[model samples]
Every structure is written in structure tokens, then in C-alpha cells.
Target: MNKELLEKGFIPDEICKVLPEGFQDIEEIASSLHKILANNQITNAVNEITQEKDLSKLTNSELERAMLLYSYVGHAYMWGKEEVEDTIPENIAVTWYEISEKLDRPPILSYASYALNNWALLDESKPLSLDNIRILQNFLSGVDEDWFIMIHVAIEYEAKNVLGSLKKYYLDEDFENKNLEDALTSIKKINEIMNRMPEKCDPYIYYNRVRPYIFGWKNNPATPKGVIYKGVEKYKDEPQLFRGETGAQSSIVPALDALLGITHSNDPLREYLDEMRIYMPSEHRGLLAGLDKFLEEGPKNKVVEHETFVNEIIGEVHKFRNKHLEYAKDYIFDQALKKQSNSNIVGTGGTPFMKYLDKHLKETVPKDD
Candidate 1:
């Protein structure tokens, strides 16, 4: 029953950061998205590329790489205009949808395409810290945008140790308190990295530049009906609503919650968290669900006796969630009130977050004594 996670944690191994020669046309434009959008060339430049390239011919990693490029290109084209675009043009729409189908996720940008699979190492020999990392693609690149996503990337990198500890605690027969101890240590480290979010990613720059491009058509005042995929037949030319990329989609928190026996009330926030599950990679979803199921079926005596460890986990989660709520207010909610309408006050993930984040933080209590 000892199930081991991948060396890279929930992140994909050997992600295709760069597509191959056949995709040179798309790759070139994707690399310069920030510049292209500034010059107002995204629409015409994107429209010119045909969708003759075959996706089935691509490897899974390449398909992921394609998704990364197409997502950046799609978001840039849609949000880049001085005026908002209600319809995704045929060229971007058709190709992006195809890639989405292959990846089995929505056509719009998600966390995987945005941060999980969207990084490169400045020195592969070194560790995956911010010093060694560089974002592969960006809409309007800046310290704010780079730090926002890179902070996420850093947190994801740190979560591997958390997952490693959980794997041992769940599957290893001799699962020890050391596993829980290590998990809490990693959990604390995760919060530490998160607290540094404001260092370079200022609230104003994040709101005006980074946050704008990630908003999905769903629940958005700018594109309330969502975006119409002009040529994707499944929609029949209707507006399709998808949530924007949010940190909730990351597998790390869900895994930690499952490990610590944390549960949320059956409410809108819980429902929204489930909705974000669809956007996660299938294997990562299995990890969250399977870990929860494993706990329900496995003997509880081992973990129950360690009330002290459980309290430590709860406290760490509380710390992380509290910091998250603060970031939500400073980085998005307050900023939205100043610049955006009521609809956009929702989280970048396309859901009301203020009340939910607070509720989730309080719900991070210890298991019944």
C-alpha cells in the first residue's frame, strides 16, 4: 500500500517548456506575448496562423507545451484589446479548443498552463528556487507578474516535501510521528514562501496588470456570458464560462487538508473547491480523493493518538489560510473595489472569496477530541 508520489510532486515531470520545430510559428508569437500585446498586434498576428498542425502527432509533454502557448496567446488576444472581446476569433478558438480536448481541460488558461507547467530553470543543475527559475511566457511581464507566478512556482516546489511526508504516513506500515513532523515543517515552509508574496508583487501592479489577463469569462462583468468559442462545435457558438486561474487549483492544499482530516462545511466555498477540481490534472485529483478515501477506510488509531501533531497541522493550516485571506484582500478584493465593478470583486478564480476564505480558515480546526 506504499504509494510513492513522483519526484516532482504533483507537477508534471519533464514538462515541455518549449514546443518543437513544427510549432515555430506559434512559439515565436507566444514568447513575445507581452510585447505583441503592447503593440496591439495580438489579434492580427494570431489570426494569421492556420490550425493545420496535427495535435495527435504531439507527445503529451508537447501537448502541454502547446496548451501553455495557446493559453497565453488566447488570453492575450481576448484581454489585450482596449475594448474587451466577446468572441474568440476562429484561429485562436479552434486550435485552443483542440488542445483543450487533448488535455481534457477547458480552453481557457488554468493553473497548470499558467504556473505548474510554465517554468524553466536558469541552471538545471541547481535547485528550483526563484533564483534559478524564469517564467516561460507572460502577458505583460513585470516584477509583479513574475513574482506572483514565481511565488506560486516556489510554493509548488516546496510542496513536494509535504507530499513525500504524506505518502509515508498513509502507506508505510511503520508510518511514524516523524512523517507528521516533516509534513508540518514543510507546511510551515509553504506559508513562509507565501508570506513573501508582497515583497515584489505589489498589490496595485498585480491588480492592474497581472489580474486582468487571468479573469475568465464566467461571472465576469466584462464578459458575463463568458467567451464564445467561434468555431468549437460543442458550444454551437455559445458563450462558454470557465473560471480564471487561481491558487485553489493547486493540489498541495487539498492534500494537506485530507491528511490532517480537515473538512469544510457543505456550502458555496466547498462547492467552488470541487469545481476547481475539474481543472486539476486527473492524477492529482486522484491523489486528493484517494487520500481522503484511504483515511476513511484505514485504521484511525495511529493518527488519533497524536493529538499534538494534529494540532500542529491545524495551526499551520490556519497560518497559511490567514495569510491567504490577507493576500486576497490586499492583492485582489480591495483592489477590485477601487478599479472593478461588483462582479469582478469575485476572486480571480471566478468565485466570491472573502467570506469563503475566512470560513475555510476557521474550519481548519483539529479533529474531534
Candidate 2:
């Protein structure tokens, strides 16, 4: 797809200039503002703005900065520190909520709003966080304008499509004996869609330009250490920042893994990848976990033919994941050339969980008694 194809309807003509050139000092300004919000000083500032009858009273620069503040502060409040409650505090939430609503819901503002409000609706006890799926509903409504957010919306679209196709088999009592070929076909279709995502959104540009501004935690080696928020003194010693890629990178991975019989192997790297699901909306996560259980006890356990078909599906899924890893590698190499940086890129391809599944599938050979 051409860049124009993605850019046409979503981005406004005025905001077209807002990204690369218009926001040169956004990082510095966003960092300073993040600290103030983190310190809970936002109540007064937010109250001041709430009193304004019209947002047009603010200058253009101020309006843009407010946009950045909504993005940064919202992320910091939700994911910055390891607070007991995952929900955003009321004072800060009201400020960003009102600001985002008044601005007609920009991509970042919508993203943060979904994170703050939508997640609380799901049951926390379930392993599969389906709340992530609820957030995708907003994306489907054409709220996301950024290329990065658009890519995620596309991913979730394809993922849900695959799941919807498989729902009938999941509900069927004779699902094991039902033609497994249909499920395989759906998996193949999803793989094709995923393969095109990087083409639609250039990973190189996304990593270098867009990724920096959206990052919450200081985990990315490419950027400086993340900013420290003021409140939650206990977290001062060891703060946790969230990178934008963490949630999007593997949103579909766990669900596919569960379908393909990829279990948690307890490897450190595998665990790290699994932990990223915490950032996902609980609803989608729960759906993945539920599908995993159904496969484990229903289809995979029942018949020899079903086992063979499942193994084939697992192989295809592994190939699909490896393709994504290749894309990551190519993006890193392309960026390295521009920066002339020699840093090694590790963990570029298959996760340990994927590898474990591949090995397990390979080792399971039919035996005659």
C-alpha cells in the first residue's frame, strides 16, 4: 500500500505538518510536562483549563503542547510506576479525559483514554485479557490517525477476523473431527495480512521518528533514559517505563501461540515476552487464554488426525512469526546505516516460546505399541 493510502482520510491537512517538522522541541517540552503531572500538580492546571469556555483561547503552540501533555501524562499515570491499582487517579483522569474529548480525540489521546477507562470494565481474574479487544473497537471506529496506531488497528482487525472464523469450530461438540483444513486456511489468511503490515507502515520511519515521542518507559536503547515522575516515592528507586512497541509488537503473538499449542516454557526471555500481555486489554488476553484451554483439552487431546493437523498449523504459525523477526532485523539494519551505530540487535526473530513450540512439535513422533 502507498503511504498516501494510509494518510489520506485519517490525518488532517493542517496536522500533516505537525509530525516531523512542527514538533522539534516536543520531546523536551513533553518531558517537563510529564514530571509536573506525575507530581499531581495537574489539578490546578487542569482546573484552569476546565474553566475556559473555548479551547481556541489558547495559542496554537499551547494547543499543540496540550496535545503532547495528554499523551505523555496519560501514559505516565497508567504505566509509568507499578502502582497497586492499574486505573488512573480521578483528578488526572478528568483533566486528560476532558482535554482529549474537547480536542476531538486525537490518536494519542484516544489511545490513552482507552487505556485508562476501557480496561477497568474487564474481569481481572481471567488470564486472557479481553479488554485489549474492547480497545480495538475504538480503533475500528476510525479514531486512530497516526500510522503507528493505524498499523495496530490493522493487526487487531486481522486477528479478530481469524478468531471469529474459528469460533464455530470452538463451539462445536465434534470440533476435533470437523475439517481442520478450514482453520488452517484462516491461519494462512491471517499470515498474509500480517506480512503486509510492515509494508503498509515502514518500520524504519516508525522506529526512528514516531516511536520516540510515544514511548513511556526508558526501556528503548535508542533513546535516553525515561523521565522520572514525581509521586510514588517508593517507585523512585526502580521505575518502570512502558515503550509503545511493547503492546503492539506482539498483540497477536500470544493468541496465535495459544492456538498452535505453544505453552509457557518458563525461560527468562519467554517470560519477559509473556509479561508484555499485562499491557494488553484484558478482554483480548482472556480470549487467547480461553482458546488455549479449548485446544489443549478438546481438539489436541482427542484424535490422531487432529494432532497431525495441529502440528501442521503449528509449523505454519512458526514460519509466520519468523517472518516478523526478519522484518525487525531488516528495520534495525536500515536504521543502523543512517546512525552509523554498531550496537548488536539481539532477540530480533523468534521468541523462546515460539522456539519451544517448534521443538515440541518436532519431537512428537507417532509410535506403534
Candidate 3:
């Protein structure tokens, strides 16, 4: 529960692309994933990887790469083609599930894989920004897909600007008002970064190409009963439901919500946000837990600046949520429906996000009760 994020926010300090010789085959598949998908060679290519590779003696870093590679390949196998596949092959399923169990998250693509651990700096000496950063993986490569992930990376970079202050705010017994104020400023800046999404990634392209590969089995018509993992004993070959990679799984907003005492209305969306906590890295989830306890008697005083700080924080939250709602409408809700896979009604996270996001936006008032 200690403040582990000093500079990187939720992003790992490095992507650690270098793996042991055992993982070389998996790494090879990940390198040309788009080509494999284009030629419909995913099934055999991925299964062959687990055959020789003994996952028993790998490092945590190696497992992370396993998650990343398997997730990209799994999504591509399911959604890369015209029709969705219902069953995950045995080797792919077992390898993905084993690594997922080691990581304590579901066996599907989440935000951590999509953006948090998916980027690398072009110039190591330079700061982490869109200009210096590039993604390590892709679904079906395109500007729309690359831009979509990098934009999230940019926002994550900006969010870290507040982490030092937030860490101080969390650890200090006094709940320093200065720390809170500094974080409010960075939160406002994070919203500005989010505004740049449409500058390159066209909403049309994002809704179609970029989003399809990220959708999970839950609440999805393509795999209506969820997905079956062929050889994973934990599932007994039953279909398992897991939400897809979504911003809801990101820790930035949730940490702010816990800190600033912002509360969403009691609804399914609230439940969904709570459910997303499990998808996040364990440390982030612990940070939120610490903040909730830290605030019990903390933020302890109500000085003149306290009201102003709280109001400004609330204002930024409003702006962030409203802007997200606007983007949701443009990027997903209002876009023309082309395929059953990319439904305008349901989000990639496998929820009726259009309805819930609008409600969640309206419910974000200047003050919480």
C-alpha cells in the first residue's frame, strides 16, 4: 500500500522486451502478429509456442510478456476475422490462464496490457511523452490503432505529474492542503491530454478496427455464453465472462475519486467500476484502499483553501467525466454500426456503456452527498 508510483504513475518504468531463450518463440509470434492474423495463421502458430516452452521456470517479468503476447494473439484469433471464435484453444487457454493466475487477473486483454505495459520510449534520455513513446504491440496495425493506445499513454504520463504530491498527501499525517492543491492542478492538466484523442485517431476508424480486438466475452453477442477455455481445469471448460480492456480499469481516475471523495450514484455503473478494480494491477487497487482509510480522519481540516481546493477538484472531475462522455458519444455511441462485433450499443468492456456513461456524467455534480 506504500506509494510505489513516484514518477511513472501506473506505467511500468520499462516494458522489458528482452526475455529468456525459452520465451523466444512467443516473442517471435508477437513481432509479426498482424501478418499472422492477415494470413489466418494464429491458431497453429500460438498453440505451437506452448508445446516446447516450459512455463514452470519463468520470471514474473517473463510472465508479463506472456500475458501481453497471449492477449494480443487471443484477441486477434477471436476478433481478427469476420466471424468471432467461441472457444480458446487448449494450449493458448492453459498458457494464458496460468500466467493470468500468476498475475491475479482475468485471462483477457486489460488496460495494463493495452497501454500501461505496452509502450516504450523512442529516446531513453527524453521524458515519457507521445513524441518519444511508441507502442510495443498491436492488433491489426494502423494509425488509428497506434494513435488510440498512445493517447492513453500520454494521459498516463501527465497523471504521474501529480503522483509525487499525491504520495506526500497520502503519507503525511496532516493531509497537507498544498499537496492536494498541486494534485488538483495536475488533474486538470490530465483532462487537457485526454482532449487530444481525435487529433489523429478518427472516431470511425477507432470504433471499427481498433475496438473490435479489445472486446471481452461478457455481455457480448459474439460469444453470448462467454468463452470456453479448452484445457484450463479452473474453468472446467465452462464459458467464463470477463470485461475487456477499458479506461475503467485504469487507476488514475479511481485514485482521484478515492482522494477527492467523489462518489458515483448507486447503480450498475457503480457496480461495474467496483468490478473493474480486480482488473487493475494489485498495487493500484491497494493504493485506493489506503486512500479510503487515509481519508477517514484525514483531509481533516476545512480552512478557506479547503473549500476552494475541493471545489476545483470537483470541477476537474466534472470536466473529465463530461469530456469522456462526449468522446464516448463521438467515438462509440454515435458512430455508424457496421458489424455485430462492434456494437454501438455496448462497449468493448462488455457493458451498455452509452447509457451508463451518460448517466455517470450527469451524476457527477459539483458536490457529493
Ranking by TM-score: 1, 3, 2
TM-score of each: 0.95, 0.52, 0.91
lDDT tens readout by residue for model 2, 11-119: 1222111223333343333435545444554333333332222344555334444554545545544433434223444434444444444554421333323222222
138-187: candidate 1 lDDT, tens digit per residue:
89898789889999999999988877886677666778878889888988
Q: Which stretches of candidate 2 lie above 4 Å from their native place?
A: 1-69, 72-148, 165-172, 176-179, 218-226, 231-240, 247-251, 288-299, 344-369
What's the best-to-worst order under lDDT? Answer: 1, 3, 2
lDDT of each: 0.83, 0.43, 0.78
> Which tens-of-lDDT digit does each residue in 87-191 have in candidate 3?
988867888888898888999999988888888889989987777888889977878898889989988888877766666665555667788788788888788
Which model, 1 or 3, shows the larger lDDT? 1
- CA RMSD, predictions in order: 2.0, 13.1, 2.6
Q: What 10-residue stretch in candidate 3 is worst by lDDT? A: 296-305
**Top candidate by lDDT:** 1
